[model samples]
Target: MVETTSHTATVRLPGSKSVTARALFLAALADGTSRLITPLEAADTVAFADGLSTLGFPVDRGGDVWSITGNPTGPPAETAVVWCHDSGTAARFLPALVSLGAGDFVIDASEQMRARPMGPLLRALGSLGVRVHAANGDRIPLRIDADGVEGGVVQVDAGASSQYLSALCLMAPGTRNGLTIEVLDEVSVPYVELTLAMMREFGVTATRQGSRITIGPGTYQARDYVIEPDASTASYFFAAAAVTGNTVTVLGLGRNSRQGDLRFATEVLSAMGCEVTVDDDRTTVTGPTHLRSPGEVVMRDISDTMMTLAAIAPYADGPVRITDVGNCRIKESDRIDAMASALDACGITVHTGADWLEITPGRPHSALVQTRADHRIAMSMSVLGIRTAGIRFDDADCVGKTFPGFHQELAGLQEAWQRG
Candidate 1:
């Protein structure tokens, strides 16, 4: 086994991809130039910037900050090509921005993203009067002809993906008729709230009343914003500590941060027997030498960490039950199935249910992991590989979607432990 020696180290992460993507969209749609400080410079966020640039938003990066010029009047290109690649944020959010533009836009993605769900968001855009043309049902390589979004009441079941609702909400302020989004069923509700909170910072108002969100026929005002550290990415390092019996400290993810994934440290890791201490400056995770099961975990809101916890499941002393994470099936990959398959490859017994997974611990054998072109899968599986040998990745580069230096971070972990 390639178990890491117990060590103490504080790691500083790049800015939040979720916040950076939304900020880029809002800044691109605003009237004034907005300065994004310490934004995430990763593949997915870069795809967002590239797509926005294609839509005529000039993004300039110098040092850690990004200066993006907003194009309030829409893209100059009448017919635009927007590439979302493997980013769910770009796939879902960018289409709504196109609907607010006076142009014909075509969006495409990698094979991984093509398999994810987007029909609900597309149909919602169609309800706003944008002509959507999807090839072979509602997949990417689709065309959108938009004079502009004339929003009224748009309904979407965000249960499959909260990005579906965020896609509609981001461009609602720019719509002529405003918008009232009816959430048929919601998952990752905190992410939607984060989007709204960022929207308010950009000078747009989104009032959430129960499942319906009312937004005005308004516009975003560009402002200087600082992106918080990535909480989703933080889960991996936290998992590193948990699996290796080390102390991992993450800097910049303060307690007041908006990224909902931070709760994974508190709810999941701590519940799994790690000692978690959060403060305004940083969060520290001290792993127990012997891992324990936290019983059944319901990961409805903090489902992004589903795979992270899955990576740690093999190390558990007893069976660990995970529930309320059915929506994970539609993420970058079928995470439930991916976890099942990966765990099975490592000799762990995994029982899959419609909305739950029960992972029974065993002496894990090293196995080649398949990432399915999913960032979370790559990262999570990497964590599992740390404490076990023969942990090879089929597509290790997929972590570039969020954490470009993830492998380097793993290397740094080794250095810290060695130094200790």
Candidate 2:
């Protein structure tokens, strides 16, 4: 980790992982050729594209711009297995995509991914007339025997992850009868909105009426799409500024960003006493001399940045309490538990509940951070490493899951901060 006290920095991050994954899926299902400009090239997204290729979707992943020839009918393969690695999006979203084909598709995943929840999505698929056979029940390594999805009314419990509803929504256009989804419980609702927005960009329309959302029978029209910078990843640099009382500007994400996580800059950072300025294409955060706590905040929609706040909380003027993020338990790791453990290891006073984390302000000491093979954990801890000495990560390499060059960029920032 790059340890430093200076915090003035400017960062240009990669495309949004959520948007890139959704674009890959949508591009694969479009009726013609689709071009993804500056798409994210990382482990999880590569797995998604590779899985698409395995299912017979022609994906040309050359350079930053990827071209995909969409097949609206479905995957060309009659039988195939998609190894999703640790990508929850692929593990959850691809099964629904493959269900639109007349084949037996097995969606497999890494050991960690297999432990995450999939029941809600599987049950919804089953309700839509797709046969799901899972030996372990509700988990991956499951086979979906599909003639085609004759999508109709189905109910889904999206309390664990909104990807369940987003997955079904992404594939709804290709179904014969369209889809009427009744969401029983929803968390991270903003992600589903992103999916719907992208669907509309590709020329498909959907409507939401309270808990019910409807998508009529149609197919996506292939078009060139440009992905925005990742807001969740930018939170780390924003936190760096807050921790060290300096300024940081992240380019390519501002008022026009479709990602809900952008609230971390416009809302969370501002609430923490950082002067946040959001222009059309960039956001600048000037940290307060003494960071203030944004007490008792609910992170259900922007939970991905929960660790970013937790990392900088020890420097706050008061205790920082984040709540309503119970869904973090089923992420790449038990994110809530992981944050609690990492914060505790840093010799900071902390408390955790089923859906909340509270960190009391105290002088933090150096400790080895355990990343639990999660990208978010690694990146968030790196933010703390900026102000604390001896803050090392056990598995820093896991950051390759999303931002492959995170360490290098952070190191560059450290050097730039020191030079000035």
Candidate 3:
């Protein structure tokens, strides 16, 4: 394990993983060929792109960009076994997409992915006239017998996963019946907006009358799309600024980034006593003399930053309360529990509830953090270890899920800081 050192640095992050993955999926379903510039090449995005190819989408990657010639109507074949690996997006989003083809398809994933929940999305698919075969009650390693979607009204409990709503919306335009999606509870409103924004980019419009959305019969137009730098990944570096009392600038994510996770800086960082600056193509965070507690924050939209704030909690002057992030439980791991447990293992005072966590300011000791193969856990914990000591983890490579070469970038940042 390498000790992290933070100094004033400009960190150029990879493209937004969420946008890249969403674009890849949309590109594969577009009317013509679409090109993606500076797309993220991480494990999850690769899994998404590869999964699309496996399902007969034929993604072409070359030179400075990648292109996909899509079948706007849907996948060309009827029967396919989609290999989702451990990508939650692919595992959840692909089934609805495959429903567009009138065939029997099996959706399977890696061991870890299989452990994640899929029941809600499965039930939502079932309501859309897709025949599902999940012996274990609509989980992964499931099969679908779909004769195309007869979309009408689908009720989704977005509390578990917003991808359920996004998947249905993306496939809605191609469905003969279109779709009227009603959200019982939405975990992340921004994620759904990102989906809607991309759908518009593809020349389709989804009308949302409050909690219900109507989408249909519109064709997806193929166009060149550029992905933004990851706001989630930028959260850690922004935390580095707050913790190390240095300036950290994340390049490429601007003031108007659609990635809702960017609010980590605007909300969490500023509330934590850091000065944040947003420009046209970059955001910079400058640390205060000492970090302060944000008091209480409900991360319904930017819950991915909970770990980042958790990392900074121990240094704050008061307890930090994070609520309304219960949806994080069904992510790569139960992030709330993972974070609480890791903080406990690190000798920090952590109070965990069903959906809320209160972390008290205290000095943390050397601890072996168990990451549970969660990328956010590893990266967020690493941010905490920047100025602290003996923060070790065996599964640091888990960051490859979203930010491949993450440690390399950390090392480079530290090296440059040291040289300065």
Candidate 4:
């Protein structure tokens, strides 16, 4: 049994991998050398680096520093096979960018990656005169044959994943002509905003009017950029203080973040009876006397933090319901089932459906959780394990997929036994 105790701790989160990868890709397409500070060095970012390298982008790394030479005129290389592993952002974004090259290029990944839907993206690309083939339905291991993108009007379903829309937008400027994207049933709209905001920082403009976005054919101007702290990773530490009745402050993230998951701190503090103060560069969360369950929270905007919500659910006084998150079913794993199953194993009754999860707090029970090789699952289970008596996580090393220092960060909060 690995015994752990709850304690007060303040932690600083790494830069957002989501933002870093997009910024890196844009920088690679810029006109000159781009400098990115506080960038995440996780597997996903590494995969993005590999994809750029395969396409002839010059990338140099030293310690926590990174430099990318822009290839605004396009790469000198031809089509080649690029593997994105299970990184959806890499898989989705790379395909559109590769369309700028000539020849047949294939993007492949793990079995789980192959299961994630890519039909919406494929259909949208096809509408823009790009040919794509999915070895298994509309999933990964996608093959793309591109001479170049013929820009025109394209319609896409934004309900599935915002990455699809963002990918198209990123590739729009490199097309033969400008492109206009009409979205149908948009969800997780904040992520799209983040993408557009980053594009503007790189000298590309994407105008979002209602559900439609128009991108003009232009070159990306390379410039020095600094990635902001990851809001998703910040949620775990914030939740720690909220659940354990302690004071914890997360540095490098604040009110003016382009990342939408930053809003999670406000929602969590509001629900768990904590006082939240957001300043220019930091956010402090102070726990209350007792945490109360805010039953039925609509989490459409903050869907990425659903796992953190599940981790804190066991501490709530009553049933905690999470809704408007059907998109969770299509992430790195089927988060809906994975969360309910993990919580159920811990002696909690979880009422779950296609799009909602209802968790009732009860006595903590020890159980080994299967993380399904998902980074968020592994992180969430580890956080919950802090409050449990005997907890073991299978594939705990899967945290390297995103946050490589996750275990070390958890160790800072409390003592945990590591088994070989």
Candidate 5:
């Protein structure tokens, strides 16, 4: 079992995996080369590498360097089916690229991915003249025959996953007639903005008018792009500071980040009575005597930070109610259930519903946390472990799926405690 202790420390998070994946997909369609800095080297990114390789794009990954040579002309023949594993980004983004191919390609995933919904994206693809068939009725192992795409006006339900809308927008400019996307009840609007920002960086412009988005026919121009630090991952350190009454500085991020999760720093730190300052590329958070739990918070935009918030609940003075997070149910793990189970095991009072989590602040308890093969679960639980007397985590290796440097960062913080 890995052991950790609470301490005052500063650390930097890796580049946003969500941004890296989207930027790589867009760069692969660009006319030139693109360079990404501090890119996340994890399972999800590896899945994207495999998918891009199958699509005829050359991707090289070593240490912290990721190089991509895009195929602006289009992908080669799909002689084999691509396995996207459990990565929803790969599953959604690659399907749109496959629509430009001349042959049939079948995209399949693990059991967990199959359990996740794909109907919204499939329906939108069908409207764009791509033939898609799902095995077991609207699930994974989707077969795609992409002779050509018409690409006029397409309506997609954005309720389940914003990736569906993102996939369509990224591939819109490549189509013969461009595309217009009408979104119905869209969640995670910030992620959609991230997608549009990345698309524009690659020389494709998209206009968002309320629930509708329009993209014109254009070609992507290859350029060097730097991915910002992951704000979602940074939330853990911010919470650590709040829980331990320490001051922590998170570097390599900004106030103007396209990542929606960046908002979590402001919301969480402010709510916890921390002094926060955001500069061009860093944020500093100073913890107060105790955190004040607002009655309820709408987390639809920053759902990724739910795990981090749950970890800090034990230090709050009152109950923390998280709402508008229905999308969390379909993440790598059912985050709502995973968080509730882990926190409850740690002797925290947790009330859970389909889309909400209400946590009552109390004393920390010793327990073993099961990560459910989810990176966020592992990181959040580890942070909580630092405050508890004795906390063991199952499957600690899950942190490598996103932040490979997590263990090292924890070690540095623990060293500070020992020295003090």
Candidate 6:
């Protein structure tokens, strides 16, 4: 970490990856043709769209507005192999989707994503009468023998990932008798809420009572949908503002947005002494004279931003402890360890627990940060480069998983900050 400096810049981000993925899933399951305006064109989304196309769902990824012809009866292909690549969303959500069709589907992921857990979703599908087999056991490179799904009571453990539950919810409306999800344990409940909200937007009703959610048998009616800007991706820019004592305004993401990651601005950044203004259509963050520690912040619901918080924590006045995010251990990388290691390489004092990490204030010297091929790691670590001149990354291009232009955007902000 380096001494804070003042700067100001405004950034326009891509569409929400969460929303784009869910919209593609919902639209493909709709009753008619659907139009998605300004959807994210990234590696993860492209993998998702390709997965859908492989499963026999038609997707036209030509321009700003991509179109998908809905297939309420599930994928038309009787046999398909989906190459999920490194996209966890594609890996988790696609299985439940293919189960709605009468076919044999093989879901294969990249080495990184295959290491993440998938047993919960598979077990829930099995309970719902879909025959599933994981070659690696609980991980992907699994096979789904689909004859169609029957909607009844299903129990799912979403503690490891909320995508498992969201996957089920997205596919519930197409089940034969509707679906009732009994979430045994869950993390990132807000993401599940986003999934539900999108489902309702597509003309389906899903109700949640306590830990149980029920979706009745219905067909999604296609309509033109506008995707919200990605809040998770915006976090790096907001962290830039906080770290450098600058003002960074992100256009199109507001307090009213359904993305749970937006709370990073309202909750985490605000707690860390940043002046946060969340309007209906935009969010702005201005850093303090110097950063202050918010102490312990439980980031289970917004765990995706945990890396952002950790990267900037060493700049604060005191130690910052982020807890309740054990799920961080299983993201695109073992984020808790990865962030701890990167901070250590920066010569910062850090400690770790099973699920938490604490960063003690120190001057983070420039170091060669190992990105582990995780996009968040690369982007979060890049924020340090704003102050630490010699900071570098081994695989910065991993940000292409979401924002391919991250390096350029941060460079622009750094230039503006320097000129001032």
Please list the residue runs of candidate 4 whose C-alpha ends up more than 4 Å from where it truly belongs after superposition: 1-8, 415-420
Tens-digit lDDT string for candidate 4 (8-78): 45668788988888898788778898888879988988888877888788888755678888776565468
How does each model score on TM-score? 0.96, 0.97, 0.96, 0.95, 0.95, 0.98
Cα RMSD, each candidate: 1.8, 2.0, 2.4, 3.4, 2.8, 1.2
Candidate 5 local lDDT, 382-415, one digit each (tens): 7887678777778888787678778678757656
TM-score of 1: 0.96
Task: State the lDDT of candidate 2 residue by residue for 1-420, as single tens digits.
Answer: 122343567888998999999999999989999999988999999999999999999999989899999999889899998999999989989999999999788999899998886899988998888999975788889898989988889999999899999999999999999999999999988899999999999999999999999999898999999988988899998888877777788989989888999898889989988889999989998888778889888999999999999998888889999999999998989898999899899888889999998999887788988899999999998988877888899998999999999999988877777777
| Cα RMSD for predicted model 1 | 1.8
Candidate 2's TM-score reads 0.97
lDDT of each: 0.87, 0.90, 0.85, 0.82, 0.81, 0.92
Q: Point out the higher-scoring one by lDDT: 3 or 6.
A: 6
lDDT of 1 at 266: 86
Sort order, lDDT high to low: 6, 2, 1, 3, 4, 5
Residue 307 in candidate 1 has what lDDT?
A: 89
- Whose lDDT is higher: candidate 2's or candidate 5's? 2
Over 4 Å off, model 6 = 1-5, 418-420
The list of candidate 3 runs beyond 4 A from truth reads 1-7
TM match of model 3 to true structure: 0.96
Off by over 4 Å in 1: 1-6
